[model samples]
Target: MTIQRLEVSNPEFTPNNTQMVTVHSSHLKRRHDINFYNVNASGQNLPVIILLHGVYGNSWVWMNLGGIDKAYEKVKAELNIPEFILAMPSDGGRLDGSAYLPSLNAGNYEKWIVEDVIDACKQTLDSVTHNSHFYISGLSMGGYGALRLGAKYPNLFNGISAHSAITKLADMAHFVETPLSEYQCEHSSEADVMYWLKKNHHQLPKIRFDCGQDDVLYESNLQFEKQLKDAQIPYLFEQFSGGHEWAYWHLHVQKTVKFFADIEQSL
Candidate 1:
């Protein structure tokens, strides 16, 4: 598919002082619609941490639930975390979420995230340039996307984090119509985490993931943790009293930023 020139809308400010939203037209695949809400950290070449939202969610999910401004205030005041721009984009595919992967029916969504979304950000944000840093994080399906992409293209990210994420494809049967067999089709997959980690595990960026104690995905997350552990992978994993809801994600999202801040400063 010919990657058409990207079209990024002007930034739209929200009632909150810390954020703005940008909707862009993608030419990479058939689902040309993409949007994100950004919390500008007020500096040039800031870390571009792209956040993918879970199913039935959009760019404003973070801003609406946790408030980026509030998170920044807490993290900076308490953790002394460095400032960074937050890019929360809508995956905008199947109702169950595109899984942030290219699919047989959903053309090239992986490229849409790994490539076009970044391109759109560079064009829309003046402070963001080609050399600006990058990071990834998400909730649930978004978390799965973050890890999958971070594992597949380790060189592009400085760190990765997810909250109550779906780690295995089999876990999605309860929520999505697409079966695991179909999801595994070569035409649908560009960097399925199942295969990508083998090639890129050594280079996978600083990783962290956590699920809530009361959440359904908690067990799978544990299994995923073991997969990483058995592979000799190092990560920060924790479980807290909560479930797979916005409350859980909002509470821990700051840790994700703090984690990324450490990685960014270390390098």
Candidate 2:
């Protein structure tokens, strides 16, 4: 993939040891932003966590709205978790969201995140490398992207976690005004999470997901959990007492950080 342009800020000037990067992606044929966080600037060969944002949000929402950076620090210090480089990229800037899917109308947002975003992190951060383990996580629509992409490309990611995800493409209607017809792909099953999960069940990595009990998508999440069990696929499912809001995500993101850290420690 071609990187037409790249810009990174000095860590000293940015908060939470964060560095912002703008990458000109060949897949999207447009420039997109990635917000990176490396607690120890000089640390090398650290694992990477790619966080995805939901509808009506961009890369900055992970830190600015959800306070993931703060949660990362708290989790690392409290749990003695290993250092991880956090990479949060935009969902290709479609209307309210791109759904992080490869669409006929919109650009190839799936490739933008699965391929370009990872390459941008390696090119911009000294701590990330080809050998670094990658984990994927997201909230809402992003949760759908994380689960689908992570399962579809098991070799690229070591673990997956999603929060209040839209279990099916049709569920997108609950949040976006974009026509669900636009998300249609060549294969009908391409938009289904269970399709990927079952297709790669033998080699799928550690998977976990959760939803606030009061969240609109809670029932769907429960149905997904049952599907996983029926298919005999391994996964972790949790239900928390909250709603589909930033407060719920912010409070629980630390669990995702810890979850990744635990996987790293096991490895």
Candidate 3:
């Protein structure tokens, strides 16, 4: 799949920021549209990091917090890190509280990510470099999406980070049974997530997860972390002071990029 570049605008943010563009294969076939902001480093061969956004959020949210561009800047500044490409996709329609799951409305979120979006990035972006690998990370629902997608397609991503992730979708369902502003969590099932894990846990990517100490989803994050620990899954788990807002996630993005950078170096 070739990247069909586009120039778009988000007046809410910086008007001058060019909407650097591309498309994934699955999207191209179905005419499914996803946006990406790509940053090329100084080196000829470099690893790539794909960033996924959270529920009710799009590619633009990461840019607003300066997280996406910051990741590029930090890694490039470190110099020890290889040149990298950051592709943040607006998982269309899946953001309506869908948690990147294959919705009745959205089809298979995981497939779109691993097969379509990623394949396109790799092929179109020249992913197979001489000295680099692929990586991914996300926040909240996107965090869940990152883990789930990485787990589903282990070879595609070298490492992953899940910040402020709603660890257990089944658990969230209970809370949504009543009502919550951001999510209709009832639509997703924990059993489904577990099924995904059961089928793909062996192929799971090296993962990192963290949540705000004061966030309501902290418990669920802890629960999933426990599951990973119990299964001897290799992962980094942490808790920091903050809440469910962008402030925590924005800060977490740096740590996430650093974590991936470290993993890339080791390999």
Candidate 4:
């Protein structure tokens, strides 16, 4: 879990308070992108919120497109929340998307996010230490990654929030052009979100997800919510008025920041 090489850009070139990071990942055997934002470098032991992007998107979408950095700053100031380090990473650069799952054909994209990305953040950001609480979040395909990964690795995340998430692996068909067969793995449960949620039901952290009423995945999200209830898992699900677009994500991401802040306060 070592970063072979690290490159950071000047803040002048990037969006507000965001620094682009490229780490040569041993897991992916290639360099991956992570857009990082930390306003207070001197702050110690700050919580980290890792934001994952959807298909055809890289790390910059969270800030450059959604203005998540600005939203984070606003939320922190308005809610009086502690400073948080925002680390947004790409989805392994697979064709259209990797769905953030380990595949027999593709490399270990799941480990790349859960292991390499976190390691890169810890190595590059002084405020993100091993003791720092981590919250996972994303939109669309990345939302599936956040929820699945958070459920699968409950020990690694303190809170989970997703917006307009693809609730199941089959939902990837709507977003990706890649054949579904390429995502096949030995363990069937590895590709299923409900399996992980049920397997780790007792250990899961506070979970929350929302979807736009007009979003393509809205029905699937409702079905997934039903599955969560059937499994007796506690979670929060909200429906808003929008579609599956950046405008929706940009407007609602503040809720995610505040959600994480509330979790931090409780802990």
Steric clashes per prediction: 0, 0, 0, 0
User: Which is better, 2 or 4, measured by lDDT?
Assistant: 2
Number of the candidate with higher TM-score, 3 or 4: 4
Model 3 pairs whose backbones collide: none
Decoy 2 TM-score against native:
0.97
* Candidate order by decreasing lDDT: 2, 4, 1, 3
Q: Could you give the C-alpha RMSD of every candidate to the true structure, in order shown?
A: 2.8, 1.2, 5.0, 1.5
Rate residue 120 of model 4 by lDDT. Answer: 78
Q: Identify the candidate with maximal lDDT.
A: 2
Model 2 has an lDDT value of 0.89
Q: Model 1: C-alpha RMSD to truth?
A: 2.8
CA deviation > 4 Å runs, candidate 1: 1-40, 177-184, 187-194
lDDT of 4 by residue, 12-43 (tens): 76655667789887767888898888744567
Question: Which one is best on TM-score?
Answer: 2
Local distance difference test values of all predictions, in order = 0.74, 0.89, 0.65, 0.88
TM-score, per-candidate, Cα-based: 0.87, 0.97, 0.77, 0.96
lDDT of 3 by residue, 147-221 (tens): 777776677778988888766665445334423323333344422444556677777767888999898888888
User: Stretches of candidate 2 above 4 Å error?
Assistant: none
Number of residue pairs clashing in candidate 2, backbone atoms closer than 3 angstroms, sequence gap of 3 or more or interchain: 0
Q: What is the lDDT of residue 120 in candidate 3?
A: 53
